[model samples]
Target chain A: MSHTVRDKAKLLARVRRMKGQMEAVERSLEAEAPCGDVLQLLASIRGALAGLTGEVIEGHLHEHVVHAENDAERDKAAAELADVLRTYIR
Target chain B: MSHTVRDKAKLLARVRRMKGQMEAVERSLEAEAPCGDVLQLLASIRGALAGLTGEVIEGHLHEHVVHAENDAERDKAAAELADVLRTYIR
Candidate 1:
């Protein structure tokens, strides 16, 4: 549980770093801004959103499934695992 | 890329199988199985979960990020990359 929380924090930090950016989009593509100038920027935003969702799902699966004490717990864990897979598939 | 899409499909299939296993685990738990057995199953499930996560992250990085075509693509790739990281961190 505690670990999950810490992990979440770490994820956020990572996001912050990414935001920094992607190094300003690689300095605007080496100043060669073209090709929709940032079609990628939009993509980036989408990615961020997906990332957040993934994190949440991951945390939930790990914490709940792992914490399980009995067979049910095991099952839960399995489900969590599946969930992670789902994310990948998506 | 096409490969990515195909990979996604494979991952999804794996998840489906895992989901079934999870269902079985639930049944076992309901059967009042021993805590030890259930615990073992839990561990396995956790492993599977981790494995799936790792694979997805690896694929995304190697394919999308590395293959990015332009600065925008790079940014998007970065964001997507961040997204995956967030999940891992969590």
Candidate 2:
């Protein structure tokens, strides 16, 4: 968490760009752009999501999984990461 | 494209929800919410994106691939879809 806080600005920026991409998708649909155009927008949105997600996962790995004070803490962090991955990578 | 046009409202609705979810992500960071909470939000966003992407892909399959007037049209559609998928499934 502390680690993520350290990188909060950068991560938030990624999220904001992604948000903007979503707005573009909305606009494209409203304008009834071609399906190819919408698909291109979706590709970018997904890329942004993957970028943000990767950063978060990396921070967790460094903070809780690798740098945890004890085995119990490490296991908990790993489990939580695994659980999130289950939901995320779907 | 006509297939997507028919489903425009529904697809736009999905994009709007995803946009709202992205805003929540922004708020969570601005409030400095815990990483766990942010990860949960990311999971939901990814799910919503996958759902929308699936629908679009299906529509393309019906319009450009399965229902194409000729082999040339089907090939072009498949190629475009493949290109999008290459970027998307990253």
Candidate 3:
């Protein structure tokens, strides 16, 4: 998306941070950390993933749902949104 | 937690799967996939993380909140739950 290209740097930053978080989770497992500690780390990763998801979704909604110029484009956007939501909610 | 020991294998499996999903996200970025594809990958990761979080949270509630031995124990559990919820929400 055009919007995505503009946000690519920020998005990639988020991706890298998430990668670090994932590795932390793996390290915790390998070290046999306490369950409470592991749960907290997983929760942090979950929060980061949610933030990233929200960023992309906000962009999608702004570009498609809110700004579609034609009826067909709007329909396509709505359909894609539904599809994404279906997967997201799972 | 005692409950965690019982479920360690299952929990580790979830962690590993989430790690794989995350690597897919990085791969998609490296391949210059469409924004839509990247977003789909993110959504899937979110779903998996949520699943794993739910599993751990369930165990925590069952072991601590539900089966707490005394008021003091229950209160501690509640406080920890609150801390985790706050972090998860952010």
Candidate 4:
């Protein structure tokens, strides 16, 4: 199994927390919270997602890229990662 | 300004590296690099994107979430962040 799958339980916990956060956002909106308040919440949610993404990415790198046995393999991994990064960031 | 905008140059530089990495992936595919090699490359690319996402997230948290002056604001920020995190990880 992929490293992410191996760590599914931990990841799922994080996901659950994220869900709770979203629910809070809904609650705030329903209550007609200030725009600044809502915006702050949104920004936090985005950050959490980013953190989760980073963790998964780090696992993949350790399992597939950094640990690769050959130079060609490592180089290839780096290239593929770079391409995806471009699309993701944009 | 959002911290990301202020640090655009550094972010862009990283983006450029990601582009270069993608180019390498394309070249490898064209040259018939082994399947294992290609998979490794893809994994790396994903990781790199994750890294970039993390950076942006950190910036947002620092500027908008952590720096908020009130407890209510902080809670809202955290909640919103959690929600987005759920969507992102899935």
Candidate models: Cα lDDT each: 0.50, 0.85, 0.76, 0.59
Candidate 1, residue B45: the lDDT equals: 46
Q: Top model by TM-score, which number?
A: 2
Candidate 4 Cα errors over 4 Å, as ranges: A68-80, A87-90, B1-90
Go through the candidates in order and give the clash count of each.
0, 0, 0, 10
TM-score of each: 0.45, 0.88, 0.78, 0.44
Model 2, residue pairs in steric clash: none
Q: Could you say which candidate leads in DockQ? A: 2
Local error of candidate 1 at residue B34 (angstroms): 1.4
Looking at model 2, residue B90 earns an lDDT score of 49
Clashing pairs in 1: none
Off by over 4 Å in 3: A64-74, A86-90, B66-74, B86-90
RMSD of each: 13.6, 2.3, 3.2, 11.8
Per-residue lDDT, model 3, residue A57, is 79
Question: What's the CA error at residue A22 for candidate 1, in Å?
Answer: 31
Residue B52 error, candidate 4, Å: 19
lDDT tens readout by residue for model 1, A61-88 = 5555666557787686676566456545
Strongest candidate by lDDT: 2
- Chain B TM-scores across candidates: 0.75, 0.88, 0.84, 0.71
Runs in model 1 with CA error above 4 Å?
A: A1-90
| Docking quality class, candidate 2 | medium
